[model samples]
Target chain A: MITAEQKPIDEIRNMIAPYKRILALGCGSCVAECAAGGEKETAMLASALRMAAKINGEEVIIEEKTIDRQCVNEFVIPLDDIMEKYDAVLSLGCGAGVQAVADMFPEVPVIPALNTEFMGETKDQGYWVESCIGCGDCMLYYFGGVCPLTRCAKHLLNGPCGGSMDGRCEVDPDVPCAWQLIIDRLSRFGALDRLEKIYPPKDWSKKEGCGPRKIVREDQQK
Target chain B: MNNVSRLKKVLENGEFAVTAECGPPRGADPESVVKKAKLLKNNVDSVNVTDNQTAIVRMSSLAACALIQGMGLDSVLQMVVRDRNRIALQSDILGASALGIRNLLCLSGDHQSFGNQGQAKGVFDLDSIQFVRVAKNMRDEKVILGGDPLSSPPDMFIGATANPFADPIQFRAVRLAKKIEAGADFIQTQCIYNLDRFETWLNMLRERGLTEKTFILGGVTPLKSPGMAKYMNNKVAGIDVPEELIKRMEGVPKDKQRKEGINICVETILRLKEMPGVKGVHIMAIEWEEAVGEIVERSGLLPRPSFD
Candidate 1:
């Protein structure tokens, strides 16, 4: 799922500095599961902003609202009528959520409240870890189902980079090296010989090209 | 840009080239950097100016390399992929080379969470492998990425880091081959205290003839105390310190621990020089720069070569 962490209140305050009337919008899906954004998050943020404004003697009003999923246009359409009343919107969702709101309401400035972290699963109650790079091409089946593209710091295709030690990544000793986990799982599965075959350099063109990606369905389309 | 070719020349000359690391300070002051460089000016073949080594913010390696060059020391500027994107990386390569800094060490730096600025975002657009390929192409091919011709290309002796101690140890030498395939001319390895495992890594390199492809500089850092040995063994990633070595350090008296540290480093240096495929030693004295000259001298690498 898409994950993010809330931006510090001071930075969020600076982002919406130009607008006095703003919408503290949230998305119910993905981000809500991560507790980054949801109806509860939106209400809490609205209350905090109100308190901050009161303490600073600033004239500001934040109206909270949440949609099913801000990445879709249908969920963002609900903001059309209310958006006219506010000068700007503060999206308490992932980056996709902010963009979706902006794509719908081109005139009102849409501010991001969280820094979209990565596509990962919930490790513990509040902790999360990245697991996928969304590289468009999936090669997880080959590397014992571990996504080196996302988990490995270098995204090395051949094997682990020279930074991993004791099954931990060199970048941060806390995180498990993706390649290590792959090697272990593959070794246990008696497929260690499969690791000798080196995959070629990933073609980034398929992943993050110059523009947005699209999957057309000719048969399903009118 | 004209390449400052002293380090390359030394390695090609086949007379064991010795390189040492001088970390750029955290502040803007260059006085200490100049002093440190001057201290090792007559002792080592080349000095590697680190790019925010250990993920901590420091004076930019490029600026520090320029400063080291001004002191008449060959400067190998370390470039990590943690901070800059491809555009900024290529631009800095041009800027550094134009300033007469030649040797470039490509690295995927330690993560930002380890440093004082944990809140900073890391921008690793290209990993060290891809970064090495990009740098070599820019220098040798005389063209920027995407086939754009450059007005003038920067001449550089491309280098990369290696970790003989990283897990999946069987693949370490093979990874070095990949780096060589990416056009790495020289490799400065992670710190070495365990000789048997290092020998195993070298055996793989020798079997594949990768030893002949690039000059391998085994990294060595003197143990200041048993605590340091324990910390490196337990805390530092890609570093494996053997228990016997730590026991040896622990056997020493409290005041003599520093002496034992130098002795162990000297011994490691001797063994590294005798080992096959090992070209030299990269002495990382950390902030204890004063001990570098002594370690080099005791290791019988004194009276550095002077090429007219």
Candidate 2:
């Protein structure tokens, strides 16, 4: 899941300052699961904005609406009728959702209300940890299912550097050293010998330097 | 024979080698590097010029090594993976060779948060081991990464670092073996204050027959004061200065602590010389290069071997 946190209320308020009438849009997907942007959050944000506007002696009209999966074009069709009623759409969604909403309604400006963090897992209640970097090429099998490229602070492949102490990273004491986890897991499976062979340099072109990555499935595209 | 590096020749000749570090100045001053190199000249086998050590911006290691070479000393160009990608790393390897640098120390440098630039983006495109393999291929295989042939390869005696005191202590030697297997011609360890733990790590290397594969240089740093000892033990990531050694430094008078520190360093170097797999001692004087000559002389490692 993509985890995100709502931007500061002041910043969001300023972004919507240019528009007298605005629509606070929300996505009921990843942002909703993270408790960042959903129907409940949208209502709360709208109420807060109204109160702030009143205190500032500004006469502004704000409306709230949430749709299922704002990134999908089919789910965004419901907003096409009412989008023209506002000067701008405050998108309480991930980056992709904001872009998708903007693509759907060309007249109304789509502004992000939440800062998209990373592709992560809900480790515990109110605790999220990054798990993937979407490197396109995966070598989790050799590393006992732990992704060194994503987890390691240095993204070290061969082994732990001289910095791993007390099973923690030198970069951050809180973060566990990825190589320690790799070694421990490989040792448990008696596969520690797998690390003997030196892993070569990563092919970063497959990751993201050249341009925006795209997938073209010929059968599904039409 | 593989390269013209004096350190390689000393180690290959089965003679105990000695190397010390020379950190570049914060500003663009080449004279500071020259002064440090001159102090270490004829006192050590090779001088390691650190690259943005502790993530603080300083003169580049390549430029410093070139300066040291100008002082008529063999230089080990310390390249860290934290700042440069593979392309820059490979390009610098060739450039260093062109400037007469013979040895290379590939390191995963200290994290940027530890340095002046805490917000700097760390460029770890290739880790230390990968850098070693890359340098070795550029030297032995006469090719760059992706097997592209170079017009001329960098003549380098590849080196890497090991921390015997780091956590999951049992796996420390295994990591060292991986580096040796990755074509690290030499291994320089994190500073050793806990001799027992270092011996255990060295024994692990011996058990795996890694002792015979590559030269191992134990690291030693002369503590300037008791506070310095405590700081290293508590703050430094991989270093573990034993409490007893700290007490030894504290026991000495304020004016005599520096002398006591040199005594302790000499003792550590002597112990390292007697160890089976330990081939040499790398004295990282850490901005106190003036004390290196005294420490080396007291350790009875004088009349430093010269291949010229």
Candidate 3:
């Protein structure tokens, strides 16, 4: 899932200070699962903005609303009527959702309240770890379900770099050496021979490096 | 392969080759590299110009190699996969070949976070193994990465680095084997302070007959001081400086530590000369280029072989 965290309140406050009427929007999908831009977070953010405005002797009117998924245009139809009422929208959705809403409401400014982090999984109640980079091409099967492109700091394909020691990455001790994890996983499954075949340089044009990417599915299109 | 590398010729003739490193200046001045190259001109077979070693910015290795080549010294163009993508890398390889640089040392450089620039995005477009294969393909197949024919392919010798001290010790030799299979003609390792561990790695190579496939050059670096030893042991990743070696450095007087370090380096080189599968010694002076000549001379590798 795409994980994100709320931006500092002061920065968010400064962005919305220019407008008197503000809308704190949230998304109920990926960001909601991570407890970042959910319904409760949107309400709390709205309350905080109101208190901040009261302390500053401002007359800012902040309202809260959340959609099932802000990335979807159908779910964003509810905001069409209310978006005209606000001077600016402080979006608590992920980067994609923020841009989606901004694309829909071309007039009002849509400011993001959260920082999009990475595509990762919830490791624990409060901890999250990145697992994928959405590199467009996946080679996890040969690596025994571990993605070296995303996990390894250097994205080494042949084997581990020399910095790995005691199964920990030299870049950060807290992070496990991705190649070690790959080696161990493959070793356990008796698939260690899979690494004998060298993987070539990745074609990064498939990713966003080249430009904006899109998938046109004629079968699924209206 | 049309081997144009002088270093490869030295190794092929059954000579114990001696190579040293020449780090480029942070500034754009060519004189600084010339000064270091002058010190190592007649003392070693070839000099390796590091490409921003440790991620710290320096003059481009290709330009530095050209500078040293003008001084009548062979140069090993150290190419790291950290800063360039496949296009830039292949272009630079051709550029070096065009400028008469015959050697290449392919490496996945130190992470950018370790360098002065923490915010720079690392461009590991090709890992070192893939880099070796790419350079090999460009040289042997006369084709670019996409299989398009190169008008003139590079006739270059390829080198790669190995760290026997890193974790999963048993797999270090296997990694070296992968590099050799990827067309690495020679291997230069991380600086060696623990001979037993190095021999253990070499034994693994010998067992797999990898020793016969490629030339192996043991790496050595003078410590300079006890603090430097401790820094390498604690701070430097992939380097193992034994505690006894540090104690030996600390055993000497503060003013004499540099001399002691050189002595230890010379001793290590002499020992490496006798080890099986060890074809040569690469002295990485690490900003102490003047000491390279003394270390090499004391190890009795003087009067470096020259082919007219």
Candidate 4:
């Protein structure tokens, strides 16, 4: 599950205070699993807003709607008609979904109610921690199952720095040292010898320093 | 004592308290919510604004609490740590306190798998017990993340949840005790339909001498119909509807089932009120707010204690 945290209600209210007709749009995808943006959350948000408006003596019209996948164009196309009914949309989807809604309905304003924190998995029932950064590359094969891109504060690809103390990151004591985790995993897999194979510095060209990256499968092309 | 301490005194006075749970709407229209709040304001002692009840998105809980406060009604802002980190949670608590929303319910909400969005991620930075402890720490220390002294520590009535009917009732009680030990001032249990089982659990509390440590609020929700009962039992975990109640609901005429449901809820509340260690009632009408007033009235719980 992608761990997501909801934006403060007062901040959300202030953002949409000017709008009379509002649509609380939920994405039935990542945000849904994280319990941040989904159909149920949409209804709950609607109910809370209705109560808030009543107490504030504000005349606001709110509607609730959810899409299968707000990040995809096909999923968002159907929302155009519904978009016409509301003055603004409060999306419970991730940043991608919110952008998709905005892209599809440029005429209507779209606001994100959740801060799309990071791509993560639920460690337990309600617990989730960051795991991947989708850097268009997978280095877990060399290290371990853990991705240094997300776990390490510096996103180091090599060994742990001197800042590591007792296997904990110096930046945040609560956070475990990512490189230490890598070493442990490598040792468990009997691949500790791989550590001697010094890796060259990462090439920034294939990553974020450059403009947006795209991948095309030659076989899938017409 | 401060305002919050005063509220705590009110609760400790053995007053017949009434609390209503308000689920925010999915969209922006606040009419239905406002109507529900208006209807509940005069009848209940405090109104609970749920935060993403059932993991569904709606209006924000903080905004709803602020709105309820603006209407001059006591608002209990429900906070679910499922989607927030410790920093965010503490920050929100401070913000809520600044907004004059003193009452808070710390919950580890339902898993995302229960909702329509099954693949969404969950952020359980801390469980209910950890959250309650954090709240207590904040109150006692008056310092946040950077060790900066708070301008004014928030005086909040920290609340937690317990489900008496949850499978392995012993574990549930243990968890409840942990929450209390973690600094839960009060506990609001899950909806109850089986009074005998609930009473047995209450007896257990008495046996363990936990009755005096925490204020227990019995949860009551009126079944709108047989379908509603089935949905809750089959779909919602830790919620059980007795076969006899189901049969009674099924036996009732379709048009009158809602009335019967209200009656059942009222009877349960009346029974629970008479039981030992039950501080008050937390009425969860689920989408049927109109019936709450009727249930409270019929249960003879009207004209509740005035804090003023």
Candidate 5:
């Protein structure tokens, strides 16, 4: 899941100050799951912006709209006819979704209303935690599903880092030690020997080292 | 010799080594590096040059290490994985070696949050243990990361850091062993203040015979003042300043607190020298290089042993 939070209302107001009429586009996927850029969030944001502008004596029109998934081309095609009616688009989506909308409508300005955090899961009610780095090479099988790359403060392949006290990281007492979790999980499965073997340096070329990563599967291509 | 580092020679010859740190200036100016190097000249065996230390922007550590060599001193080029990819790190290793750099210290680097440039993106493409393995490969196999052979390998003595005070303290030795297995020639630890804990960690290292596989340099810094002691205790990660030591500093007068700090550092050096598997001391002195000479003299690590 991609986690995000709404930007301060003031910042959003500033972004739409010059535009008299705007579209508050919500992403019904990841951002919606996180309650950041869903249909409900877009309507509330649009209403709040209209009230704020009216109170400030600014004639601004905000229209609420949501697509199934802003990152998909098919989901974004519906806005093509009405994109020109708004001065700009206030996208309540992740970075990918915002860029997707921008890619579809080259002339309309797409402003992000939420900051895309990371690929994570909702840990509690209204709380989310990052769990993966999307490194292209998945090693979760080795660590019993614990991700040192995403959870360790130092991203140490060989860790616990002398900073793992009471199963928490030194960077923050609130954060659990990723390695500690791995160790416990491995122990439960009686695979402690796996950690004894030294892991080589991460092959970054296969990961994020070369640059922005892409997975092109020729076999899956039409 | 596989490495030309004087510190390596001292350790191999069974002599106590003294390595000091020199942080590059924030700007391109080499004035501060040069001054610090001169102050530490002959007082220590080799100097450890830090890279973008604390995540702050500074003169490149490669340039600073080269400058230290120009000062007629051996420099342990400290490279962090936080900012460089394999291409840049490997390239720097080759260049640093070509520039006559013999010692290298691999680190994952301090988090960018600890530095002035919090917005800077950290490139932890490889962790410290991985960095050590690559450095070793570059030197022994005479190859780049992808197994392409090099004309001549860098005669580099690879080193990494250990923080005994970090949580799961018992795992520190295992982590150290992993680094050594990954091909670290030496290990310099985070600053040491808790002697009892350090002793236990050393015992763990020795029990596993990790002490014999790689040279271990204990890190020590003078506490400076009560405030600094408290800050290190409460703020700094991977560092543990025992309450007794902090109380010792607070026991002294404000003007004399600096001396108390030096006294504590000297005490640490003496104990570390006697401890099993301890090869030497790496005095950080963090911006207090002038006191290094005095600390070395007081700690009786002076008249540095020469294998030359």
Candidate 6:
């Protein structure tokens, strides 16, 4: 899942104020579960926009549409007719959905209503916390299902830093020390010996900041 | 306090208060609704425009309130804090007040599961009690969440909901007390069918010393038909119609069921008026506003006290 928080309603109202005909698009995938952009949020945004327009004494036409997955081409294709009708599209999906909409509807301006924070899961109802970084590597096996690369504030791979106090990370007292969690998990799994093995420094080039990464499944390809 | 204080003064002066509810259309067309507002302008003291009743999207509450106010009607803008954050809610309150919509009903609202957008995410940032607290905070201290005094705080009457028929009637008083403690000035209860139960709940409120602090408006919604009675019984939570009343509706012919429903509502209101704690009655005719005049007249509440 991708963690996101909705932008302030006033900010969203201002962003789409210029367009008379606007389509509030939502994605039912990651953002829906996170309570950022989904079908419900799209309707809310549309209602808020209409209210804001009435207050400003401006006439605006707003339409709401939600796709199962706006990050994929299959979902974006269904919006072709509505995309042609609207002057602008306000995407409530995550960053990927905005990009996909933009790619599909180059003629219309695509705006985002959410700030995609990180990849995470719903810790509970109405609460989502970060869990993974998608670092293009599998380190959870060695760490016994804990990924220090993502959970650690400093992204420390081997062990906890000196800043760790009472098993809590110094950067955020609420958070447990990622390396400590890693050690606890490994010991429980009878893999404590893995920590004694000196692992080589991770190559930063394979991460997201480098460039666009691709994975082609030869078996599935034509 | 401005207009609300004035309105309170009018009520205290023994004026027969009048209020009408304006249900927004299901779509964007506001002409018919505005026409309805015009019709009620001469009859009611204030028009209570609902905010997406049942959690379904409609013309916004604020917009409808503004339109009614613009049409020369005092507006009681209904607000549901189920979807808005503190900032948006406060700003909207201020905005509506600026547009001359003074009265407000603070509601937690129907859950989204009952609406067309059941899968839609709901943002219940603050419940009814918290909403009243926020409104009172803005009114008394003029301070917001960031501890900054607002330039001009809104002067709006805060109203909350109470249900006598809600299972475990003690919890209703407890929640009502909480709302009052949170600074709710008034309460509009769920539809009252059982007058004895309602009076008992009122006595409990008096025993708890809550009756003196807040004004309690007994809610009265006339059932249109047997189907409506069944719908309220099965679908609406916290509202339990007595089996006798259901039997009455079931016994009546289809064409005469609506008349029976109105008679039941009028009888309930008359009984409620004789009760000590009730300040007035809020008639929720649902989609049957035409029967409201008859109910009010039948209850002998007509020739309402002059505000002018």
User: Which candidate gets the maximum DockQ versus the true structure?
Assistant: 3
Higher-lDDT candidate of 1 and 2: 2
Give the worst 10-residue stretch by lDDT in candidate 5 chain B: B1-10
* CA lDDT, candidate 6, residue A65: 88
Question: Which parts of model 1 have CA positions greater than 4 angstroms off?
Answer: A3-70, A74-118, A122-128, A136-144, A154-159, A171-174, A184-222, B1-4
Model 1 TM-score (2 dp): 0.80
Q: How would you encode candidate 1's per-residue C-alpha lDDT over B139-257 as one tens digit per residue?
A: 99988767797898888999998888887887677677888998899999999999999999899999999999999999999999999999999888778999999999999999999
lDDT by residue (A1-222, candidate 5, tens digit) is: 999999999998888888988999998999999999999999999999999988999887889999999999999998988888898999999999999999999999999999899999988989999999787789998888999999998887877665566687776789998998988898899887778767776876676556777779999988
CAPRI-wise, candidate 3 is high
TM-scores of the candidates are 0.80, 0.97, 0.98, 0.59, 0.91, 0.58
- List, residue by residue over A158-187, the lDDT tens digit for candidate 1: 657766777888777788989889988988
lDDT of 5 by residue, B1-308 (tens): 23478877888888988999999998978888999999999899999999998789999999999999987798999999999988899989989998989999998888787889888887777888888999999888888877999988888889998888876665677788889999998999989998888888888888999999999899999989989999988877767888898899999999999999999999889988888788899999999999999999999877887656
TM-score of the A chain in model 1: 0.94
Give the Cα lDDT of each candidate: 0.87, 0.91, 0.92, 0.79, 0.88, 0.76
Interface residue Cα RMSD of candidate 4 after superposition: 19.3
* Chain B superposition TM-score per model: 0.98, 0.98, 0.98, 0.95, 0.97, 0.93
| Candidate 5 Cα errors over 4 Å, as ranges | A14-21, A56-61, A73-89, A101-111, A162-166, A205-222, B1-3
**Better candidate by lDDT, 1 or 3:** 3
lDDT minimum window of 10 residues, candidate 5 chain A: A203-212
Give candidate 4 regions above 4 Å deviation: A1-222, B1-9, B145-148
Which of candidates 2 and 6 reaches a greater TM-score?
Answer: 2
Which residue pairs in model 2 clash with each other?
none
- The candidate with the higher TM-score, 5 or 6, is 5
Better of 3 and 4 by TM-score: 3
How accurate locally is residue A212 in candidate 1, as Cα lDDT from 0 to 100?
A: 82
Deviating ranges (above 4 Å) for candidate 6: A1-222, B1-10, B15-18
